[model samples]
Target chain A: MKLTDTFKTAIIGLKTNKTRSALTMLGIVIGIAAVITMNSIGAGAQNLILSRVASMGSNNIFIEPGPWSKRMEKGSMMQSMVEEANITSLKREDAIAIANHPLIEMAAPFTMGVGRIVYLDVDKKSSYSGITPDGQKINENNVILGRDINEDEVKSMAKVVVLGFTLKEDLFGEEDPIGKIIRIQKTNFRVIGVMEEQGVQMFQNMDTYAFIPITTTQKLLLGTDHVKWIIAKAWDEDRIDEIVSDLRLLLRERHSIYNPSGDLAKDDFKIMTQKETADILTSVTGVLTMFLSSVAGIALVVGGIGIMNIMLVSVNERTREIGLRKAVGARKKDILNQFLMEAVTLTFLGGVIGILLGLTFSYLGGVILGNMLDLKWSAPLSLDSILLSAGVAIVIGLVFGIYPARKAAELSPIEALRYE
Target chain B: MAKTTEVIEVRDVRKEYRNGAIKTDVLQGISLKVFEGDFLAIMGPSGSGKSTLMHIMGFLDRPTSGSCNFRGKHIDSLSDDELARIRNKKMGFVFQMFNLLARTSVLDNVRLPLFYSGLKGKEELELAKRAIELVGLTDRSHHLPNQLSGGEKQRVAIARAIVNNPEVIFADEPTGNLDSKSGQQIMDVLQKLNNQGHTIVLVTHEKYTAEMAKKMILIKDGKIVYNQKVDHRRFAKDGFEK
Candidate 1:
């Protein structure tokens, strides 16, 4: 028979049993929808995390004390906490020396202290950061209310603090936070400004913190010049590695340490560049997303099996029709094409419906995150995700539908004609 | 007969089936010839191989040990595709059950044969309409097969069979599934087409229906027993029972 005639027969057959065909298509539709939705959600999360990391200043480098510092020969527990007392490596003077390097644009020394912040009647546990005037530039924090601490204020030991957006909301509510007094660790400090709303950064809420001048924090609270870690930015985006290496060498030389190699087993301090941190986060998120989609793939397998089951039933029901067609001069190839086309058409329709539903769900996901967490959720619809889902659906349909279509096409006309 | 006028020739066709290990011979050394413009009926009891012979003649089944030649061409040696082409273009088939596409309208059912005939353009529609009109189903053209009565469905099947203007029309028990009135109406339609010089071959068990043919051949045990030509004018001059 003519190819057109065969296709016409298939279309008429499908039209005659619309409900059965639709139900068969439903299995593929749900499978495609699940695959597409999972991919989109996974893609959205990765993008959100990447951008948040980028906003924290892509070129910024982080240097924190590694656990190996406690294992040094002369290290007591307290001396290990203070890298300078270990006398084997890194000191606060090393951070200043690195900042003085030609490739380094700015450097900030940080010492974390736990304190309850009190404003009016409410008191909440918060971390206090002691930063140089340049720390604001290094961390990409720009004050939205008043102003960042000036160099003069840091040098003169002013007791002024800049509160993060969330800290301000808890301390002052709708009241103006600028020029307000917030007591930290039994010491009253005047609020100079409120940082803009920064969402989660590296798993820590950025909002529930306050920044104070490093000299003032050291003199008034800790009574020591020791700092927990140092953060620095390169003069240009490309020189960060060079700056980190120079800082490590300078600290090793000044502390009279023989070995300069940074073996975690022997090193007295740890210095992590921004590249390393971002790489860790990216790999973490990448593996996480892949794992999630793989879990969702089980649903797709079940759906593909559903399609195969229904198509087998269709072949059984249409045995007589197949026999009549063959007797009327339809070639076996023509019969095969007709059934294969029906299978593909079912999957293509399902893919379209799934894409629409997935996007709608992704949009709703973003809205819910934005309202509940006060975090701007940016889950964009990715085309690669949609195309990948469609390709998978087509493969599943063709692979699963082949057996049944072949069964229908290979039916002997005489035998099928005799089938009641 | 003229040398170039032979419409079909079956030369010692043999058919056999192996049921498990035992071979059953269905058609044993059968030979026949049908000329153009002849109306022949094959009469036989069940298992007499009339249906098997009809399948071979219609190119739907292959003979085991002989040749089926149509219009001087060896159809038995043709490929499946070639056989299908010949069946689509040169042969028409009317099955006992009416075999109309159940959900299709009478017009589309008539158009079914034309789809396989490799015919297109406005001429295809015109020819289909003319065939439907010949079957006296022009007014019911848009009605589906299920909507039509038994006789009307049989007429639609006939129109579909003849729509391509085939060289020979094969009806295997064409009225076997119909009522007496519908059966007579169908036989009358076949007789009118035969009068128009179209060749027809039918298989039937009913003697009354077999008498409508100008020539009747009876088969028993895979062999022709009685072959005779009846003058229908003799019946028309008297009554059908005479």
Candidate 2:
């Protein structure tokens, strides 16, 4: 028998018991849909995170004052929170020493502290950052309303401050905040400018921060000279490796570490490039996607077993029909092909429906996730996902349908005709 | 004396069935011969092993210990696929149950054999239509089996049996499910096909039905009791006698 006829006969067989056929294929439909849906949503989420990481400038590197612990391997927010109290290893002198290199753009020593800001009658607790002009440049911040604090201010130990876009709004409420006096830690400081609106950077909401000169933050607020971390920008993107190694050697020489073994575990400070941060985050999302996909894989196995069960039952139900075909000159191969084709056709159709359902579900998931997280996300349907789902569906049918088809082919015609 | 061409030769054919430790011999050393263009009937009561004999002779079942030959090809040496090939090219079968695929139209039901015969779609359809015309079911060609009368269903089965133009047609109790009127019509159709020079083998318990065939064999308890030409061979259209 030709493949076309076998498929046609299978279709007719399925049509005869429409409800049974539909129910039999339902397991496959749900399985494939789940697989595709999970993968699509996973891919969308990975893309969103990678893009956010990319938004943190690609040529930037972070130098934090810690003894390079595994828990604080990268410059995640936890590093700064733990590094702030007594780690006096990083300072303005370190940034000054690193910024002298030809590959170096500028390094800014920075610190974070929370305090109540009082501007006339309005007052609220907010976090503040100590930044240099170079820090503002690396942060991609442009003072939209007024002038930014300059390098002379840092040398003069100026009390001038730059207010974040949201902080300015909350403190003044549409009032002109530039050159206005705001009290922090019971000391009056003039708001030099209102920084431009920035949503999220390095997983921190930058809109909620107020910036002060690093020296002023060290001398006045905390009465300490220790800085939490340093931010460095590289002039050349291609030579970031050489710049990182050069800074390591310079920082070690400045700190006067005598050991020349070059062991990272013995280092007093940890340095992380943007690439390492991006790679860690990418691997995290990759593992998450793989875990979810394996869970979906269980559904496919259950669905394939469902096909096998139904095919077995169908073989039993049509015993006499098989017998008649055999008596009428059907080869065992012909019978086997007919039944296997039926199963494969059923799953292929289910895969198509599943792809459609998965795409729809993933698009809706992306929209919902976007609304909740306030991020711009798109769920894309790639050729790889479609082809993978379709191919798996075909393989599932073949793997599950072979036993039943072979059983039908091996039946004795006389006994089958005599079957009830 | 002119010797006829023997289409089938069964010498000491035996068939047995085993259930657990119990053995039942269905066909015990049964020997028979069928010539080209012969209309043969094997008749017996229920469980007398006549059906088993017919099955063995039709190549649907293999004898346990015997030499069963068709056109000088030994059944013992032939593989299952080889047997299927011979069945597709040289044999046709009509069951008592009519065995038409449900939800299938009459034309396609007749085309079942040719599908396995490897004919192209158009040629299979053409041959099916011709066979349906021969069986006088041309008008009902597109009607499903559920809509057909008992006699018409049997005629559809006959058309299917002859659709591939086989050398022999095997009918196993074809009239068992039909009324006397319908049974007579089926016998008439079988006799007419035999007259057209196709060999026919019929299995029936009814003496009147078996009388329509040119030869009869009676089997009792796995052994043949008699094989001879029909003395008063009856015609189906003359009104069957009990």
Residue-level lDDT of model 2, residues A218-243, one tens digit each, is: 88887878788888889998999988
Best by the TM-score measure: 2
Query: Which regions of candidate 1 fall more than 4 Å away from where they truly are?
Result: A1-8, A67-92, A111-115, A151-158, A200-205, A215-229, A251-265, A370-373, B1-4, B231-242
Candidate 1 recovers a fraction of native contacts equal to 0.29
Predicted model with the maximum DockQ: 2
Off by over 4 Å in 2: A71-89, A113-127, A155-198, A215-225, A256-258
lDDT, model 1, position A321: 69
Q: What is the C-alpha DockQ of each candidate?
A: 0.41, 0.76
Worst ten-residue run, lDDT, model 2 chain A?
A72-81
Model 2, span B141-191: residue lDDT tens = 999999999999999999999988889999999999999999988999899
- DockQ-based CAPRI category assigned to the predicted complex of candidate 1: acceptable
**Which docking category, incorrect, acceptable, medium or high, applies to candidate 2?**
medium
Q: A124-243 in candidate 1: lDDT tens per residue?
A: 989888887787777777889999998898889999999989888888989998888889988999999989987776545767878889888888976777777788787787877777
TM-score of each: 0.88, 0.92
